[model samples]
Target: MELHSHRMTALVLLMAAVALAGCRPEAEVAGGALDATDGDPPATRTALDPAAASAPITLEDVMEFDPRYLIGISYPPGMERYPGLAAELRRYAEAARAELMAAVEDLGPSSEDRMRAPYDLALSFDLLMETPEIVAVQAGGSLYTGGAHGIPLVARFVWLPQRDEMLTAASLFQGREGWHEVSAFVRESLHTSLSQRLEADALAPADRFRLLASGGEMIDEGTAPEAGNFAQFEPVPGVDGRLRALRFVFPPYQVGPYSDGVQTVEVPSAVLLPHLSPEYRGLFAAG
Candidate 1:
């Protein structure tokens, strides 16, 4: 399930806030935002060529409705094969791109921090140049037929920028280290974005909450004549004694005049484990 609109919008705003706040130090490294030159190889056009690989796929390319998800093209011999792999590839790629866009836009302008402007610019530039890959991680064992969880699958895409050269997922996940890696990127991005927009003035709190509440009210209206729902998050304790929580709220909010009438229903961790990205799942499993 997708995140409810209000939360999505709020999270986007919060993520922007955090990115601007400089909460995490490794954002530059994890997001590949600070390791490239001004003229690093531009995002190639090869992704447009069906027979060519190594090209970066844009979010728009994967959003098109089609049976073939990988830009309506097939992978070459060397490309790894997996069931429903093409579709999953597109989904993850689009998701990754969307997150990247959100992260970048939240960064705002560089005038706020003239000294760090170059760092922000470097991150933006590297993001454009980086290519993310998807990897299939086994879920270990299954309960029913002893086979894998077939219908819903999980996968991981380790985003290793050629410039930074991170060691590996194992190295990153050593005692909350992996999550710190991701969080760091998000933090830096948030800090950069926030520092720039600090003096812009805050939105009206009353109006903002009212807008979200109205959206929630609309969702309540749509619930059944007798049924009801509530928002929540389910936490799954990690093997390493840490808790990995997955919170699934309502569908993303549709922006409009009455968009404020929305409510989000949270899904449990067990329900979401099957739906997480492979990379996300691996980080928890390793913990």
Candidate 2:
């Protein structure tokens, strides 16, 4: 989601400035543990001024868009009355359902719980799709006391089926008290899948080194109750105050646009560090 801020006074000043001068993207590179070359390359960084006194912010500093910012999951304004919204939502829902089905096919059914498993789940799947973003203008004043304007988190991309897919597991557990029987396995499977996928991306020796050499950025997209309360997200900054880093969900990579949902995607230090992985120590020396 994007927001535009204009102060009556600042707008006039900006106009005058723009009329006289042009703007440029800023670059400020510094030594840090999280180097740009080591992680997901960031988008362009444009700073107003490095010497100016103001809050320090970088492209990676964006906050997540969560449910707290939504007005409900339906169409926004004139759209509900507009002729195309319902059809559009239906289209997105169908696409999302197809994607989910593909994921289910990949996972297949678990040996024991055919009902709860993806291939043979007892309950049905329900998809939830949120409306896409639209133009917005604030008629009122600042949301914050300090004259800071607040932007409603707009839904940029949404393609969930608008239905929920739930599978009951009581029969599989044989009347077990809780999820203890399968929760851990499910978590492990997700973790393993995510790790392998990330590792596979770094197939080349240089690529492996690049990925494991540095710490990447992280973002906390706010929660959205309307979209089944799915968490929102933003990319984290690299050491150079740049918006450079891969922003993916952890674990269940099958369901996310960016991340798979596991906390960190990294090669074990033992695997990357020379002495830790004795067999690879000589390999590092050669490099």
Candidate 3:
């Protein structure tokens, strides 16, 4: 969804191409906006997608007519081979779908707000790096549920086929203290970036202070000393096949305003090695 009208128009057109093309959209509302009445019969004089007079609103109808409810999912080149991972990704999309259904129920069929910003979900996966050591993947997308903009969903998975489990951020560190160390480093980096951006904009002192104060709070909370706060991290591999760094990913509204978009801080191996769990240390080259 676009926060601005012009962008909204553009995104709607693009979404028709990108998102509508998948999930086998419904026939009734198949063409455009959900509550639109473009093809009403002369007798009806008025109608909506899933057109109340045409048929009852069912899940299938929603999927077929409203492209918004149609979850668009795409996998990387060889992700299908891993049934476990594939199932996990599908579950994520299904959850969003369930939520969309709930919202539809909340907003009755005749609600005008339903036309404001139709709900939607689109996910894409990138097979960042795959090897015997680890199968690193990054999954990201947007979920729109009638807002000015869609909420971002992002995740990083380091699948260990040998261990038959994921290498989560919490498990990678020795103890709670590791989070504190990484938190401090990431917080500093993000704050510095925010300062540079504010200065570059050359706003008045009052505006600068207002932005810095609000942005600082978000960065602090988003980068707090907790594994959950820094849940999404991408592993950067070195030539030697060892992890050279971890790029922590913070979705928009987590570390800054939505306009600022997603932000990241790449903590090199040297900065992370000290706090890494003994067993996990082998995943990285000595920094």
Best by TM-score: 3
Please identify model 1 stretches exceeding 4 Å from their true place: 1-79, 87-209, 218-287
What is the clash count of model 1? 31
TM-score, one value per model: 0.21, 0.19, 0.76
List per-prediction Cα lDDT, in the order shown: 0.27, 0.24, 0.63
Over 54-131, each residue of candidate 3 has an lDDT whose tens digit, in order, gives 232222111223633435555554544554454454455566557656765566555466565455555554567787
RMSD of each: 19.6, 24.3, 12.2
Name the top lDDT candidate. 3
Backbone clashes under 3 angstroms, per model: 31, 31, 3
Which scores greater on lDDT, model 2 or model 3? 3
Question: TM-score of model 2 relative to the true fold?
Answer: 0.19
lDDT score, candidate 3: 0.63
The CA lDDT at 37 in model 3 is 12
Candidate 2 lDDT trough over 10 residues, lowest sum = 136-145
Off by over 4 Å in 3: 1-68, 111-114
